[model samples]
Target chain A: MPLSAAAPRRPQAGNRAYLFITPFLVCFVLLFLLPLAYAGYLSLFKDQLVGGTVFVGLDNYLRAVQDARLLDGVLRVALFFLIQVPIMLLVALAVALAVDSGLLRLANMFRLGVFIPYAVPSVVAALMWGYLYGPDFGPLTQLGERLGFAAPRLLGDSWMLASLGNIVTWEFAGYNMIILFSALRTVPVERYEAAAVDGAGPWRIAWHIKIPALRPALLLCLIFSVIGSFQLFAEPNLIQRLAPTVIDSSYTPNLYAYSLAFTSQQVNYAAAVSFLLGFVILVVSYAVLLLTTRRPRR
Target chain B: MTTTIERPRSRRRTAAGSHVARRPRSERRSNLLTLGMGALLVYFLFPLFWLVIAATKNTGDLFSTFGLWLGEDFSLFSNIQATFTHNHGEYARWMANTLVYAVVSAVGAASLATFAGYGFARYTFRGRGPLLGLILGTIMVPTTALAIPTYLLFSKVDLVNTPWAIILPSLVSPFGLFLMWVYARDAVSDSVLEAARIDGAGELTIFFKVTLRSLVPGFVTVLLFTLVATWNNYFLPLIMLNDPSYYPITVGLSSWSAQAVGGNGSNAELLASVVTGSLLSIIPLIAAFLLLQRYWQSGLSAGAVKE
Candidate 1:
């Protein structure tokens, strides 16, 4: 029988619907699925000298586990979280509370002013801050000289990591504040009024009412901050050109991966490292999301 | 209980509520806190204010003028002219490329994500939950981790230097997919779909005609979020594009800064371009937000709450 006659009379709704979604499906598979599959395949092999990259199953994963640079990069980002996330989130929470209080004049001005940094591209922000951190011609170094206090080199080994953390915190605190403030808004004025009637002071209210209500939002910021911190590349990579001694080609894992793939031209090993890193991030992020998103018991 | 209300009432009776509100012991404390916060806000905004003021001054004034203060000469218009004229209008080209990339990717991604979301929400397909979970799992892969592999893949296909390099990645936003799924689930009622079905409407018709109409707010929300994300994307293009002409504004400005630091030319010209470019770059986003302020502000809350 002819296919036109044999098929359902209604223009094949399944085919039509599938066709409607094919563009997305096709693009997703091409970009994400294919790359992921390729990464997985590459991860199972190692570069063999004579065989010219023979299949050495599990060798890459074993090497990744023992890699000193990867381990150091992981520790560095862990230290970053220990120092950065708390301070940033605390400042953001404070700002959000101040803005939400409705007591402060120029609320919108302050809000926009603070949030403006978030809109600035991180590359540009890093460059601008890099200029300011310059020991020779920068405003900070100049100001320090005028004040007669020897300002430590901000991008030096002893202080470069902290300096980078400061830049990250500065650029992102306001963005997190917007998220936190928006979350605070959903807590209802009635809850505050009720607290006030109960003789709760502002401090008491913040601790008991606001902080508790902001748990989920805080978790969200932390999760994202962790992911963002782990993916540190552009800032340190750009800054590396300025202070070669401080940041190596593999200062962070992403930069390491970049150097491996592009500069070193070791695409297969780079793919392995990328997949390994991706898996680690995936586990950590999902763990955080799962733990944060679970409902609180009544 | 009554004391809280009575306190404000008594405070209202005093002259200069602003001053009176600052006089009491408790009020004075709060005032100090507010003033401290105000100063912190200024610290946060200083860079932006520096950009604005510096944009007004020429090369000589940029150095001679006080770092934090405005200069006597206002050469903002001249600066703008120089920014456009230098490098054969590279900045303008970057602006056009950025607009095309952002608009097309944002619009394209949002539409695709919505359809995916609707499919997940309305249809009962095999392995839907696991597929959704896999999609969500992709979000956990820190984007930079995939940069190397993605670059190699694109390179293999000879798409490394093209705009498609950026556009393709932008269109596969997993967060947009997740958001649209949530929105479609809550916003589109099954009863409405059933009613449409009883009226002889097919699934495609119901989705396009009924569900999509009700999903306007969601569509706008996804569009705005994706737009901002695409506009701010730097890493992808930095890795993909080797040519300066193909550079988006973010990458283009960064390159200019690098050239300045390298002593390739007058740093002021590049700095001026950055200042003008940033101010102009934010204009469209600000305008979009202002125009859709109500919808967008609520959308942020909706997104945060749903999480």
Candidate 2:
């Protein structure tokens, strides 16, 4: 009897645990769980001319499947992920390795310098970069002209995505580098010493040892980058105000959802789009984690 | 040492060869890496420096002069004054709104996340793992994706454009919750709680008096993150708030920048104010970082250096 009683837990303590967690669960359900459920509900319906929602059952999902703008947004973000993730992660890794070497003077200063931009608001960073990329009074344009080169229009249709990519990379590279550098510090020094004694160069040692040890952090950074990449909004949205002719209402999925709800007054469709985006993010994020985590096949 | 020098000629040969052989290539590479790092550093820092200089200049100098160079006039005080004064003191109201929103939301989020994290870490419950995975998924699902849905829900409740709409969403930071959970798991032991419980401390008392003290660093990290995130939140407020009077500095300054850009030559003061406003916006962040740097620095190296 005593063993069984102890095995189930002290009901009093279990009750207390329930009591403590109730607040969180309440907030979680009300804010997150409920909204998610509401989104799912909305996803199943369509707008009716009778001023009410009609149950359309999965028609919205089917429409989303064939939606060209959503597809274009996905493809655009795919391009963004391909080009930006490698560049950002490489730079972050290089900086982390350099900082971890313990040989760089003013390391803290450099680290802070790199990380400061991340602390700046994304909108402000976008604005600052937007201004920098502007043709008139833009230092980049003036400098490029002085150097006898054409100042490529950055906010136009051709390069707007790339410009946004630059802003994001600038904003987050330091953050990712900090993550990687911290991971790098955890690496045992003896491994490097052993490699050094074997006449292995820094490149060989880094590739063989540091990179392997940083796998988890690198994975985390990649996961975060994927999440952030797909949620691209503020840069394009803010820039759209200044250059709306180039950046259409559907420049990105989030923007599309925003315009749908607020501008076009298609709340149901926007909710559907939001769910579709959430689903896509979930799928891509899961795939990324699975792909990154799977052991390389022999 | 002397005995080694006498007996180990091979080791000495290896050491000397190691130095001579490894020196040139490593030195050259290090130099090249250093140069590259320097260039990257400049590329990152130059714009911020430009913003600082631009902030000091009046509107006439903003366009007529080089952005990278310093202007002759010093109108930063006037620019800040103008930022506050020009729009019926709406910028000041916006700053106040930002402070209120950021402080309340950040502190609230940190508190909730910490409490939730402690609960998650200390208790055994049904569906815990799945619940945790759900939270982690929430972290990956960009807050932007939820903006419209959240707005729709808020609008249904007639809460759009209000502080609650922004504050409510800001309070649920899955990443912050995760951090707190991880921190509490290791930092707060069951025995400590047991001792506290045995000493007649209630759960609230134990959490506030004991657990929170140990979790100060995590709290600071979360607070800083929430502060930066909430303060810089543009899209949420952009969609939520229709009134310019309720705009946070980011949106306010963005609108100012756009309007100034559109106004052509006459809106130089507004442009100058925007520049000044941009510089001002960074001060709190820099100050917070410097003041809370020990926490920030320690937060990075905490789980990082542990093998």
Error of 1 at B237 (Å): 1.1
Residues B123-224, candidate 1, lDDT per residue (tens digit)?
A: 554455676777866766677776666777788789999999989888887777776776676677767777887899977778878988766766787898
TM-score of chain A of each: 0.87, 0.91
On the 0 to 100 scale, the lDDT of residue B196 in model 1 is 88
At residue A31, give the lDDT of candidate 2. 79
| DockQ for the candidates, in order | 0.30, 0.39
- What would the DockQ be for model 2? 0.39
TM-score for candidate 1, please give it. 0.86
- The alpha-carbon deviation from the true structure for residue B67 of candidate 2, after best TM-score superposition, in angstroms, is 1.7
Docking class of 1: acceptable
- Work out the iRMS of candidate 2: 7.8
Docking class of 2: acceptable
Q: Count clashing pairs, candidate 1.
A: 0
Q: What TM-score does candidate 2 reach?
A: 0.90
Error of 1 at A93 (Å): 1.5
